[model samples]
Target: MRKSMPEQNTVPTSHEVGSFFRQSETSLFAIILICGGLLAGLAFLDSGQHGLSLVGLGVALGITFMGFQYGFASGWRRFLQIGDGSAVSLHFILAALCALVFIPVTASGLGPSGSLAPVSVSLFVGAFIFGVGMQLANGCGSGVLFSFGGGSGRMIVALPFFVMGSVIGSVILPTFLTFGSLDPIEIGASLDLSGKLGLNLLLLLGAAGLFFWLGRRQGFGLTKRMLGATILIAVLCWAVFMVSRHPWGVTFGFTLWGAKIANLIGLPIEQTTFWNWPGPQRALTHSVLSDTSSLMDFAMIVGAGLWASLSGAFGKADWPDGAQLFAAAIGGLLMGIGARLGFGCNIGAFLAGTASGSMHGWIWFVMAMAGSVLGIRLRARFGF
Candidate 1:
């Protein structure tokens, strides 16, 4: 594994630009060609700029995520173990920044649709399970993507099962709906733009403040590098919404990927109520490149792969023991299933959900945090 650094958020005092380019020429060229070809192919299809633009944004996302080693799963674990809230505070900061833009832009009808979801029975149960799974697998949706991209053998094994779990969840999602759910509740649905923005800012900043207090021993501020990464992510995620007219999402793409594979294996996915929906049917018929989340997912992988090469950190992780492997498998399944039943993962339901003014986002955070506590307790049993 790559060696750990002493400090993650320190700002440099002077310009010390050493050799930053560590990636090989072959890798650099291959990524360029692949990106260029995808853009060109999109142009050939006469697809709008959204499809092609996502390819670039996706890469940028992967690079930032990998370069910073921003592990949502690990962040929670750190908080539980040592009361370190630096990472958790950073998360709140990111969400607040997004809310500053998202509330206004979406209110004006000039940007993407909100990442809303019903506050439901499934949401509660699903998010809790996902929390436990993320800890066991040691990755969330974005975590697994970059981890696998950086050549983690354990994550590679978990990836396929994640897809399988997504498909299974999708099949049962409608059934879960019948168990009773409330309509999605926006934080300030009745308020005007300025009013909602003010309220959301108050809440989000308050969250950041709470974490800051809990992590007092570690200090409340971010490293200079991490600060930059957080801003870049906020900008890139907003860009995704601007280009696609939909908020950033991760887990559903996994669901779609799984469904396609299931159909091939004679699962009769086409006969399912969820797949037969107009939107899903269109997505199923079209090539994966045409799916916004899928394209971004693929690009994130490439981006992470490129970062690993540049950082010279790829192929450093040793394979896991049998118990860890088993945990990864079960964890993958739980995350996939949780994302489907819960209506999103950390990225989808929590970050984007809160940013887009969905109240379910807060519900997700509470329940998942509880689940994480349990996951931590079970880690020893799993030989983690």
Candidate 2:
């Protein structure tokens, strides 16, 4: 009787098999898109037709979108839930890691925000305004691009205004610079320590640990999947640096795009001090696809869109009410001005700046957070 025990079912259920295939297909498709996109961008760069590089940039963004989807779908959503600071903490950690690895190994220079400006009155004011704008728009610089790619209707509305605001900010940037800014400060350069890099690594680790503890206390405990996603994102950031020969940037492209449009419409944008710079001048005179930042920005939006559509994450386009629209416009304006005055937005200033070990990045983070609190309060009035 004991030998007559029922046989166990060893085979996987049909549903399990189907799920496996779906996941495999998704992963394979993402890989193909990423590889193809990177190749296309490189080819364009080699051909010296930088303006057409958007095709490649879009593909790269698609990869990033897939990464985000993976993170969100894989128990990482908790860190992104409202009121959780884990996302910001993760950003800082990734930046520090980037600095540690890329700077020493690849000899990567500091991020765009590495050249710090003095702690002037405009710095505080601009950061505060940028923070408020980010909350109201429900997106920062990268956030907006990714959100738009991910089928967020609101972001579509916010994107153009963001561009316009950036242009305006660029136009007025000279005024802000003249407002008594101290010379830019670089932490690693200024320090006299024998092992400056080692000290930076230690400090960054301490900050990451502090943020992790704080996030856990706030009920946003880190998960294994989130850690994996962070590692992947770090790799992507490194790749970007290797390819672009500069750390990742977003808003500078926005400013350039805006300036180009202005110039097309008979605005003497070239006369401005900001645009008179060699880099800005070159970008202005060339095709948009030639600008790495703009190309990447465009690609990110397309990639996000593809991901959102495939993943069923795309939201329907719902028009906002008058108050919400007003808020969006104002928010875009503030973010534009704030980013220019503060030397960069969250991505450029906080993430990239911190990764580069710039003191200004830390300053931007503190002021922006303060602004976010107020922005949140204001956002509620607009029924967000």
Candidate 3:
């Protein structure tokens, strides 16, 4: 006689989970595809800076989609059979890969950092503080956006406080600047790469090797359906990154949005340094950051999350108790203070810095990790 298998013992396949969301995510994906096609077509027709090669852009988007989901599963979601370290490990590798390629690109006058040399002190400090804040608030700027979009009540409160903190920090920036030396990192001047293209090619190879090794060691084990979800996220992130000409900075977008609404209502929102203070006298600080694409990107991310939640397919996360809220508010304020002092957030400083080969990014990571550990411990004390 054959042994009978128990129904409950069977694991739910990744395919099933993916199939459930196929209708929702796929429809959204189609919209994205259409919009991307239109944008590329226009860019091609105009022959301007905005007119990037559709094929190249598509490839980059594919890589990004794969990379983000891979990390998300391996790190945050812990979906893969790997431990917690897997996600962060991949992130650092990618960041380093980005820096290797980007440093040379910056040298060639084609990247974001104007003077790209070594990382600056401001960048490191900003990244460190931003990391701590992300852990405290339970998400990065981008994390918050998506979480909120997915119908997180706690994130609703958190997002507002974050904007308010940034605004206040911006207002007090002049006083802070008086105590600092604002200088650019002249990486182009200091770095001595023999050939930019050759270095970039090497970097690309290294990144490919890393992905293959990681995949082999810890297979996604996701069915084709689950893989589709991963792909969708990665593609979205890559497209946003390329179009912005900068790494994704979700917090800035939200902050800018808050400032815009306030200004529209005739509030003295612009009077605050947070919204309109100058940057090192080298740049004018106004509502220039309040743009269409960044804001739309932020909105869409949240919307996607919300759709996930409403369908009851997403996790049921909740708001923190009074103690947790206090910590979040304080953490948000500290993050704002740090971001102002350091000159960016996690996305702008840590991720961008690491990608650009700035030493500051490493320092920020160390400090932020310390902060996260402390915050998590504190949260645990409250029984959260």
lDDT of 3 by residue, 43-101 (tens): 45544444343323433433333223232211432312242343454554455445544
Instruction: List per-prediction Cα lDDT, in the order shown.
Output: 0.82, 0.68, 0.49
How well does candidate 3 match the true structure in TM-score terms? 0.62
Question: What's each prediction's TM-score?
Answer: 0.89, 0.79, 0.62
Cα RMSD to native, each candidate?
8.3, 12.0, 10.4
TM-score for candidate 1, please give it: 0.89
Better of 1 and 2 by lDDT: 1
Which candidate number would show the highest TM-score if scored against the true structure?
1
List candidate 1 segments past 4 Å from native. 1-48, 218-221
* Top-scoring candidate (lDDT): 1
Candidate 1: residue 30 Cα off by (Å): 3.8
Ranking by lDDT: 1, 2, 3
Model 2 CA deviation exceeding 4 Å by range: 1-58, 65-83, 105-119, 190-194, 315-320
User: What lDDT tens digits, residue by residue, belong to model 2 across residues 1-384?
Assistant: 467769986644445534453555455447646754664666476455443444555455555645464321112123333545566566667777777655464333344223345666667777777888888887788777777665454666778888888888878777877877776666667554436567667767777777777777877755677666777777766766655666677888889888988888998989988888888888898877677777777777667655654664443324466677677777777788788878778777777777766677778877887787777778879987
